[model samples]
Target: MFSYTGGVVLFAAVLHASWNAMLHGNRDRFLSMTWMSIAIGVVSACVVLYLPLPPKAAWPYIVASGLVHIVYNVSLVRSYRRGDLAQAYPIARGSSPMLVTLGAAIFAHEAIGPLHALGIALISGGIMALALQGGRVSRAGALAALTTGVTIAIYTVIDGIGVRLSDGEALTYTAWMFMFYWLMPVIFVAKRGAPALWSPLTETPMAVGSSLAGGLVSIAAYGIVIWAMQAGAMGAVSALRETSVVFAALIGRVFLQEPVSAKRWLACVVVAAGAVCLGL
Candidate 1:
């Protein structure tokens, strides 16, 4: 299961990067993200109908996760708006694992070994380096990306507990989480002229297709991470999952035409080393 978990999460990293890249490229990120949420909502609602409902004890965590997800989505949109994909993606993805590791050790009572501690340090330092290396990012963008990372850690810890409490039924917990969580964004967009807000998603074929693709991939990536948490330490799972930053940097450089300096490449290598240490 350990090896399988690593493989699954690495695959998820690809999907996570792919969807984020798509979101970063969208001219109207709000509309793109909104439509993506709507698509995921539709799919998750269907999945929830067949899966067993999460236990009552898990409800609070689920609700908490949903609220944190709202902050994460908002921060992510703002981060992308203010910064390039390579800059924002690493800062956001890199910051979460260490936070999750410390949170797990403190709240979850998960013990961290010397190697794990080293891994967390390397990962966090490397990610922050990517963000702070050059004056390539705006102050607002850097703040947003950092905020996004903190939110990711918050929700990850919440969902880790929520899934464990759901009678080992991670899928059911995830389906319900997605079903309810997306409502936050939908409500936000609807308030700003509902018709106008939704037109890009509803009226344009290309936008609709991208939303569907991004939504499905995003759901699959996170769903796999939630599942992996069931069989691994939340911190380790999170660190492994965050290898997405490497893929995101590559995607940004190749597809998005973002600059990828030697410093950025070195940072990605450091993140990989950290992930390997966590797995050890």
Candidate 2:
């Protein structure tokens, strides 16, 4: 079950990195994010209207997931601004699966065997290696990225339970979850006032297209991962999907002109190997 789901999640990871690279390629990060959020909002709203409401019990998790997603968006945008996509992307994504593993062990009583622990350690080390550039590591950037990872893990676990509680309405839960997730960007734009927000929109079509792509990818990646968790282990599903870090590294090297040292490549290999182990 996990092997099949992991394959789909791997494709999701590729899409995930592709859209992020698209966002990073844009000049106006804020505008790109705004457009992406709007696209996500529109799609999610359409899906929500067509689907049934989630069960009452799923509401709390869905709401909490939305709030966490807001934090993730804010942190991700900030992190991207602070450093190279190669640096930020790996750190932010690589840290989450381990946290999810820990959370599952403690909260859900999911047991982690010795091999899984080693796999988690390798993934963490690889992420760290990728984040460090020229022997200079940004502790703040790492923390911010880790915070994003933690929040993702929180929602992963929440949604894992949510899908089960939704009486098998995974689609309904996901649609509404994204609908609520879009609210944070709207609130952020409102808080920033109109001028600061609208300036980015007028800038370029590349920016708009990038944001739309990002929004669509976000919807697809997460929706598939959530569904995978419904059909497999939450921890394994999160870990396997995050192998997108490897893809992110490749995108960074080729497109962003970020340095990918031999050591970092080795780390990427280790992370990929760990993911394969977890899938097995």
What are the per-residue Cα lDDT tens digits for candidate 2 across 33-121? 77788888899989888888899998998988878887777777777886788877877877787778778778677777777676667
RMSD of 1: 1.6
Clashes of 1: 0
Model 1 C-alpha lDDT per residue in residues 46-163, reported as the tens digit of each score: 8988987789999999888977887787789889999888888888988898889889878888877888777777877787777777787788888899899999999999998788
Which sections of candidate 1 miss by over 4 Å? 201-203
Q: Whole-model Cα lDDT per candidate?
A: 0.84, 0.78
Per-prediction CA RMSD (Å):
1.6, 1.9
Among residues 3 or more apart in sequence or in different chains, the pairs in candidate 1 whose N, CA or C atoms overlap within 3 Å are none
List the pairs of residues colliding in candidate 2.
none
TM-score (all chains, Cα) for each model:
0.95, 0.92
Error at 97, model 1, angstroms? 1.2
